[model samples]
Target: MSARLRPLIAALALAAVASLTLGAAPAATAAPAPKPAGDDFPHPDLRLTYDATVRYRSEQAAIADGYQRTDECVEDPQLGGMGYHYVKPAHIGSTDPTRPAAILYEEDHKTGKRELVAVEWVVPNTGQSWPVLFGQPFDGPFDFEPVGPHYSLHAWIFKKNPSGVFSPYNPRVHCGPCPEGHAHP
Candidate 1:
């Protein structure tokens, strides 16, 4: 090749390569983003929900915000405990993750103190399909007396659950044996 022609040819090749790169469409099979760290939430909605509800760690704060303790302290010796469910009737059937219908509290047997452990979303089963949150389905269409048929999901955001974060029950939760003849206060 002639010396003068070599430079022009190299310039043409470079221009062709640049055009191919700049004009081509992006790859369709590009890899999805990496998963979040183990301690971090995979969903932004879940993280928002956690931030909104973590303030309920104070039982008084929860009560002041219209959360009322239900009649029973739910516990099952074999299956595990759901602790005391403090529910806000007005918030039921809410689809918003940041607005949970109930907050769960675990009681310390000896001290008679309560600690917030989880948040729950409840939707009345009006024959509709179960609501899904964070890609998980609500647990039931269970009929329980006054509540009738309902679907519920629990997220153990404040407490670690060996059963799983979304599991309905936690073995670590306890209803407790209240002092003397007094029931769990």
Candidate 2:
């Protein structure tokens, strides 16, 4: 082959190889599916509930922590009754040592249905009472079960005195010598 022609032919061959190599690379793998909803952290077998009212309070905190969406806490009026579901993301810690952290559930107008949806530990200082500004202009029906077993404080929002301060004397603190049936386990 003539010298000048030889160089042209080689350059064409190189371009063809480059095109084939570019086409052969695999497309980037799709991101792994998001952690499945409702999967318990640690394990699923161990679960418990604190005060029904307190459970509701912790859910409010989870919402305030900017961990979950505010809309998740909105009552589902179409459920024939008010129902709110608290969803805790996987990274949030668990309140109960035995179970993964939990989400909160309050069935509107219903008693004895207050519960925690355990996924992992509930974060500290996440709980706050009504009249406390968390988000925009929130006046609260804030209620929650105490963080169970993991700490001494029962549920997040304990009752304050009629004077509007939390007191050891206040009837809301349910630990030692609590009023009849106020015992938490």
Model 2 lDDT per residue over 24-126, tens place = 8655675752332223412232223322223235555656644453233322222211123344456333444332233434332225434332222334343
Report the C-alpha displacement of residue 60, candidate 1, in angstroms: 0.6
TM-score for all models, in order of appearance: 0.71, 0.21
* Model 1 vs. true fold: TM: 0.71
Model 2 TM-score on a 0 to 1 scale:
0.21
Model 1 per-residue lDDT tens digits across residues 35-145: 322346545677777778876878889999999977578988876788899989998998798999999988776677787888899999998877998898999988886
| Over 4 Å off, model 2 | 1-59, 66-83, 92-101, 110-185
Give the Å error, residue 151, model 1. 0.5
Q: Evaluate all candidate structures by whole-model CA lDDT and list the values in order.
A: 0.81, 0.34
Q: Quick one: how many clashes does candidate 1 have?
A: 0
